[model samples]
Target: MVRLFILLAAVQLVLFVLALISCLSAARVRNAPRLVWVLVILLIPLLGPLAYFLWGRPLPAPEEGTVPRRRRAPSAPDDDPDFLRSVDTEQSRREREALAQWEKELENGEPDKPQGSA
Candidate 1:
C-alpha cells in the first residue's frame, strides 16, 4: 500500500519533469498555450502532465538526412521530360494554327500587305 503510493508518486514526479522539459523545448505546443501547460503540470500534478504528454506535445520532426522522400520540382522546363515533350507538341500546334489562318485569309481575298507600309 505505502510502497505502491511511493511508486506512484515517483512516476508522477518523473512525468512532471518530462512534461516540463517537453513544453520548454517544443517549437509549438498543440491545443493550449505553454503557460497553461506549465501551470497545469505544476498545479494539478499527475493528470496535468499526463494530459500534456498525450496531446499538448508536438511529434518529433524528421531528421536532416532521414526525411521522407518527395518528388522535387523541376528547376527549368528543360529539366522536365513532360514539359519538353509538351513544348514540341505546342510549337507544332501553333505552326498548324498559323498556317490554317493564313490559308483562310488567302481564301477571303485579304491582301497580305507588309505591315507599316503605305
Candidate 2:
C-alpha cells in the first residue's frame, strides 16, 4: 500500500538522521574509521546504523584533566598511620586498665599472681 511505503520511507529517514547525528557527535569510534562510518550510514541505511550501534561506538573515554580512578593499595596496620595511631591508643587504654586493677589489688593486700598462672 502507499501508506506502508510512506511509513517505511519515514522510518528510513529517521534512522539515517539518527545515525548521522550519532556518528558526528561521538568523540571516538570503534572497529572502523569515522569516514567509513559516514559512508556506510549514507550508502547502506538500516544495517549500517545497526552495526554502528552494536560495535562501532567506543566506550566513553575519561575527559581531559580528570584522573582515572585507581584502587588504593592494601596496607598493614603498622604501615597505615591512622591504624598505627588507633593501635597505640588501644594499647595505652589496656595498660591503664591493668594498672588500675593492680592498684586495687594492692589496696586489698592481695599479692600479684604470675601472669601465666591466670
Q: What is the TM-score of candidate 2?
A: 0.48
Per candidate, the number of residue pairs that clash is 0, 0
lDDT of 1 by residue, 1-118 (tens): 9999999999998999999999999899999999999998889979999999898989777788896657897998899999999999999999999999999999999978899999
Q: Candidate 2 on 2-117: residue-level lDDT in tens?
A: 99999988988888888889999998798889999989988887888878878887777789999877766547666787788888999999999999999999999989888888
Candidate-wise lDDT, in order:
0.91, 0.86
Best by TM-score: 1
